[model samples]
Target chain A: MNWLIDFFGNAANWSGSDGIPTRILEHLEFSAAAFLIAAVIAAPLGLLIGHTGRGAFIVVVSANAARALPTLGLLVLVVLLIGVGTVLPVLIPLVVLAVPPILVNTYEGVRGVDADLRDAAYGMGLRGRQVLFKVLTPSALPLILLGLRLSAIQVVSTASVAAFVGLGGLGRFIIDGLATKTYSDVIGGAVLIALLALAVQLGFTLLNRVVVSPGVRQVR
Target chain B: MNDEPLVRWDWIARNWDNGGPSAIKTLLESHVVMALLPVVFGLLIALPLGVACARWRWLYQPTAGLMNVVYSLPSLVLFSIFLSVTGLTQSTVIIPLTFFTLAVLIPAVVDGLGSVPEHVRQSAVAMGFRPLRRLLQVELPVAVPVVLGGLRVATVSSISLVSVGALIGQGGLGNLFIDGWQRQFYTPIVVGIVLIVLLAVLSDGLLVLAQRLLTPWSRARRRTA
Candidate 1:
């Protein structure tokens, strides 16, 4: 359709605008920051919760509840509290969104470890921490990596919500296009988001191959 | 005794006087109505599609792969595509949402059918039941729980994603949130968020209740505290 051509033609024009690259970088930067922070906080807590077997229910329920909160609402609320344009607006909600998959996967992975193998570890007089690190962690790596893959994909998709707060990303194109009724810009932005999602998914698949042991992968 | 108005409460009071309550009700009603149609339609289409997919391995892989792509694309992006192609309207929302539901439900239905015990299918055939009768009589009952689980996920996702329809001027809870954002009013945003969360939880709970009612045989395994 002529509309499609016009849209693509206009999108090409916007490529020269500095906002495009800045928006893309800011989006990635926010997503990466949120993911790293969440991984740091969640991975260890997941390990602790899984090892102890206490509070597993509480952690998972809380995380799921948190994930269910509308990202836009959270972004607005955080912006209200912290004021707009700070990185916190983007970071906090993503951390909340990213946590559930990571925690669930870690807990499930650790809990899923063969009971006999764990018993063997314990029978060797390994302390709780020793067993967790030496026995549980390595064995649970594949599942935990799966969780990380899921979390990364989620974070990538969600990071676009940052554009709602006037923080920049591929969402900027979509939002701006909507306002102006520009179809091509909207499609361009969407294509970029989809591409980003695919890239993240593929990235995790590669990471899963490297980080997950073949023996563990086969078990599942 | 305190007369000082809370900013949050004051925002709500002003909006309430401005017909916010009616707006909220309309929004809730619209959301339920919009979400229900796609869910029903998608389930109807997906059930047979899934069974067919399960039966034919060649069709299974391509259909499943396409569904995965549909699942991964953001709801807003889907809405935008629909809007541009069809022009903004309820059809845009309904069509894409239905497609999205099918994307999830079909795979789930296929998985559910596949999960039915091999022996059960074999026995149905042994008894001389035709393929259709066997599917309906044997596989469907067993597959109900798994299919319902997928429906539950799809339903919740649909409810949330339907809010994106508000972007194109379709009135729903998402409209409240967006209007609040434009007006810089926090109350409508809060009300919208609370309403959506409530809708999701309530609907999911209802689905679970339905699962229990429909699958009484599975109830014996339910943990009794």
Candidate 2:
């Protein structure tokens, strides 16, 4: 226990490239970048598919398939295929990981827009693009945010896998500690990751409240 | 000899047997034990808690809060925390995985029960069915399709997650990834990834079959639709 206190207490551990702060930043950067890419790709695609009602079968099967893929396996494969030491190995798998939740939720969210509401928009002389952005997107916002919440937290938790491939994140403390047989560092690392995850969860709750419309927030 | 580690046919062939130490077969055996045990135990524990939540209704919110905390926590972090308490052993791995499975299963099970149509319960009551008997005989049978669907999601994810336990030298098929990483060999890593996915797919198919076999009504409904 003293080891944990001492570990964090060291002012030196709070700054610099190898510091706790830096590692936390790295973890957040990885999660945010992957999430942004996934949302950009999936959310738009979901709107198109949900609007047209095409590719429902593909979306369902792929979402299930994506979740079952081993992160470590994908990590190693990506690194093997495209040589490691770059950030792509970690970033690519995470984008892949983040995609399913966002895509599925976005698709479901758009698909779930009330048919009457959609018909009302069409009757108003709204074209497809206007209907999607105005009607489906707002209606789907609650679920889209929910999907983002799930994806963000998941990517953050799993980002530690990057440490295995010789990248630094919050996982560095856990992975390196294990290799060095430093028990305290390992425990401390785990504790920090848990804190970060909880923070993300809490942050999402707040984000959901702020971003979602009051009428639809009741739906959640 | 070219060593040919990427497509190391000879190395892979030798390491695949059931007879050898750390063979793929042996790893898979241990993997099944470590992976499936958590989902089984999680089902046992979660189903009841979920039912309790369904009954109480108020319990759902708190139960969800607890499950979220568990689900959001990284598997690597959770395993290390257990490692400190249980020391280096399979129990350390199993305990965390059980919690992970619970995070998925409880919500699924609870929703499955809750999603049972209100009128169905009302009719069952009008038919002189007691609350307990209605739950067991009426609600449960109707709930099977939804519960089984949840189980498929929970179990497939569990199999993949069990591999994360390799960080502490405790996961089953994870040993392959670890070993391959150390040797810079691709054979075991590729085999491990491919096999775990196939296993998830196959298991998912079986569960779908279970849902079909158990819920002829749902299947018939689908047919009519």
Candidate that would win on TM-score: 2
lDDT (0 to 1) per candidate: 0.77, 0.86
lDDT of residue A198 for candidate 1: 74
Residue-by-residue lDDT tens digits, candidate 1, B1-225: 123221477656555546554456667888887777788889999988998999997999899778767766776677777777688667778888898899989989888998998898898999999998888888998999999998887787777777767766663677776777776667777787787888888888999999889888787666552
Off by over 4 Å in 1: A1-17, A120-127, B1-22, B126-128, B220-225
Pairs of residues clashing in candidate 2: none
DockQ, cand. 1: 0.37
Q: Per-residue alpha-carbon lDDT of model 2 for B1-225, expressed as tens digits?
A: 124456677787888885976889988988888888988899899888989998898899999999889988988999998988898888988899899888888888887887789999999999999998999898988888778877888889889988888889887898888888777788889888888998898888999888888888987887899
Candidate 2 vs. truth: CA RMSD? 2.0
Error of 2 at A121 (Å): 1.6
lDDT of 1 at B19: 54
Per-prediction DockQ, in order? 0.37, 0.63
Candidate 2 docking class = medium
